[model samples]
Target: MPVPVGVIEQRDDGPLRRGPRAPAWRRGAAALCAGALPALAFPAPSWWWCAYVALVPWLLLAGSAPTRGRAALDGWLGGAGYMVAVHHWLFGSVHVFIVVLGGLLGLLWAPWGVLVRSLLGGADGPPGAGRSAAALAVVPSAWLLVEIVRSWQGLGGPWGVLGASQWQVVPALRLASVGGVWLVSLAVVAVNVAVALVIVSAASRLTATVALVLGAVATGSVWAWAPLPAESGAAPRIAVVQPGIVSRAPGSPQLRFARSEELTRQVADGRADLVVWGESSVTHSLATHPSLGRRLTALSRTLGADVLVNIDAPDTDARGRHGIFKRSTLVGPGGPTGVTYDKMRLVPLGEYVPARRLLGWVTSVGRAAGQDRVAGRRQVVMTVPRRDGGSLRVGPLICFESAFPDMSRNLANDGAQVLVVQSSTATFQDTWAPAQHASLGALRAAETGRPVVHATLTGVSAVFGPHGERVGRELPTARSASAVYEVPLAQGATLYDRFGDWAVYVAVAVVAAFCAWRGLRRTPGARGGLLRRPLSAPPVPPAHTVHGSPARPGR
Candidate 1:
């Protein structure tokens, strides 16, 4: 029936507002698939190109969500998939609790999903180039924020960031220098958004395509044109000792030390300026094992080089408290310089349980310690007096710390010409963990413009230049005891080391603009996109009818 003249009619568009919402099961399935996509971009699988489109599945789901609440759920589910897939090996360490951990950390991306859908208009907002551009900028910034938050050691530390997915991509590593991994992360997310728009934005495909092209060109130009730092004065011949082993279960520090010392003997001729051992190379404490300490001293004197060994042992304070510490100590021909760098950022289940009383019940594949490895106060660079001449500074990052970009950057900024990662990936050798662990050194080298000596126990020992270029062939997961490589120093600093994460500034600006735009468009009972609540929130009742009369309650 037709409405009478002067009477108004409401237009109902489609089932989206109230139709049987996408089934809970389908939504969940999509989320899991989308979330796990990024994992293929990481190690073991090592499909680096996959990262370019990994988030597309999740982004598409979120951009079309019926309500802000549903979008958040989708995002959360996807985030959960991502967490579980990337850190699935944690099951070996934390056992069944990995599920709970993924769920908890997945909360980090719930708000992000909602934001993406809101910018895509979710079920109600109009789609246009303006909105698309805004989404592209804000979504990536939001991702960075999420990464930064979840990166806290309490959560899991910053293990598998989206940018680190590009650890082997030279250009991406170049991007790391200026913005750190966060910057590369930002770029990756932005590219994903642009790619999404090509399929979704019908009216503005040309604009989306142009934006995509420009983004690609700009990233390429920055990488291709960037200048490589000059080679500095000295090229030191350094020997890295990796006492390869199959398992560390029955492995005592003494046994590991003996194996390392033997390997050092093979490589540490007068030709070597320094001999560096992998983490826990010296299982005994110098204070407790004076004999072993004397042996190291004698070895250094005989080789005419400085010895840097990692001591994983107990240090009892005057308070009579016992604590285990993993430290990198420098001992010379004369004696110990007393300069040591302790492992600051430790692995959650591997090194220490976060909450021992509550969660300690969940044990790792490796035995959980009664006490965690104590954290170091700060970053230290050990200066070794070159046997031939002037002194060369070496910065230390313990096993897990190499996975964090900021730690390496800190050491480089502090005048470390050579960055050494003393690591033990024996736990996950059969898995892709060893290769993935070894690859992280490339980004560190590129970001800091310093040579990285990635010495390890078990396998995958490698070296890289200031630009992340390989200095020599890497030893894979095997029993290769030692390798010697001459690393040339790169002079000066990359814009990244000098400037810090400039990408964060871009993220901050985008976020601020998004917030401001949301605030200005506020309507009665209608909050802007950023603050939109889920379908669970009570819908606002109409204040007045089109006829200008107050509408009835519950109408």
Candidate 2:
């Protein structure tokens, strides 16, 4: 029954066989779970270290895919999972619609998945150093493009940027100052790529190791040698008033206004330089409701400091159209300072339904804005007098605008001394939304080298110093109180403020250069006439007859 030592065996049923593949549903679930892993690295958990390796599982799953199509599917499902996980708190407001948005946005990752398969998922074996090197540069660049596209205001401004997870890390903050969040994001993705390569193939370990070392060296060099924000020796005491969630009845805005007034009165006279109230702290416009103006003037005189408050009320624009506008108005002792900044970037569904004619029915499903809020024309930096006879330049952002780095950077460049963000997450106060919203202030502060006051109505109000460090104790959702921060002013412009998103430009160049290189590699040689074969060339043989006698001229 034994076969000869040198004999070969063949089967009619099949040529070769490998292990059975995982089912589609199982693969999708794995990708989803892998994608969600990065959310834990953000606030509430604040496991900042987890972010460094959070994308590993997703990368592994995509790299080992049996086909390029399967890898693309994994990428899309994983992206959807990431979006849902990071913005899970929106479920209380948008319900199932958030998943729909997530799926639509997840499409951006399909090409990235295919790119991963092409570069790393070789059937022969683990990729060589050449492919791994290309993966290192190209993969992260592709990821950055995805982030940039999704950051549009319609899609959801930059709410949960991966670099933002490093808001609390000092070295990462330094990198942010140099290149804004884009650089930090680039570094983070590159590290993930290097780690994935090291884990998948022994041949790539050397390249991955080199990348890791170079990354560490670059980070260290920037931290040690980068220009830091110089201390201006002026510490302004900024007080933030947060009145925890009030009633939601018909007269709730009036009740919330009264609560905020009560908290403002609790602060001792002359102890604060500036008092800030949360967004929508005043329900009506001061021009129409002069009584509200008088109340704010009384508080300003009592505290011997100007009061900054947000107004959400109906107003007739120059075009005679009536709409609600969220405005940040500054109140001094004389009454209204006549200085205000209307919120330019309105929250997508929360403020207005995009393409209202088609999607207006969403209002029936949840608490989406019945009417779209009007957007402002430009940004404003108001001048306020300090207690020491000096003046302060204050830049104001209403709620969602704080998530945008360019707004704050532009304000700082335009000579704003301190950036104030008035926010209210009353709808999802009990969830992680409040904390996640608060964390953005730190990133903005680090990027602009200006202290950020993230004063909120419901809870989790916080302040970050110029270096992205917490300035004072945070006022949590359960507390209805006023806290003052002795925020230090920093001088000199950050590299990010001067250069403005240079990291993004560099990334674009890298991607473009890589594309050009690939195209050049595939082009026909200059000496060759054309890429196609000529009819004069010998005809190709069939796979079954490769080893048979060679064909003669006409055989």
Best by TM-score: 2
lDDT of 1 by residue, 1-555 (tens): 444555433222111443345678988888988998999998888999989898988998988876667788988999999998988876676666778889889988999988888776564554688888787789999999999889887788887889988988878988887778898999899888877877786854666788888987987888776666788786998888877773456765557777777888887553788898877777778898799889999889888898888888887533354688898899998888788877888888778887788877766334555568887778888888886788899999999889777788888889899999989877677876788788888888888899999988877889998888888788777765677788989988887888877778878888988888777765446333333333333446558889999988888
Model 1 pairs in collision: 69-534, 93-364, 177-496
List the candidates' TM-scores in order.
0.89, 0.91
Each model's RMSD to truth, in Å?
Answer: 6.0, 5.6
Computed on alpha carbons, the lDDT of every model, listed in order, comes to 0.81, 0.86
lDDT of model 2 at position 78: 90
User: Candidate 2 on 366-458: residue-level lDDT in tens?
Assistant: 889998999988999999999899989999999999988999999999999899999999889788888888999999999999999999998
Query: Which residue pairs collide, candidate 2?
Result: none
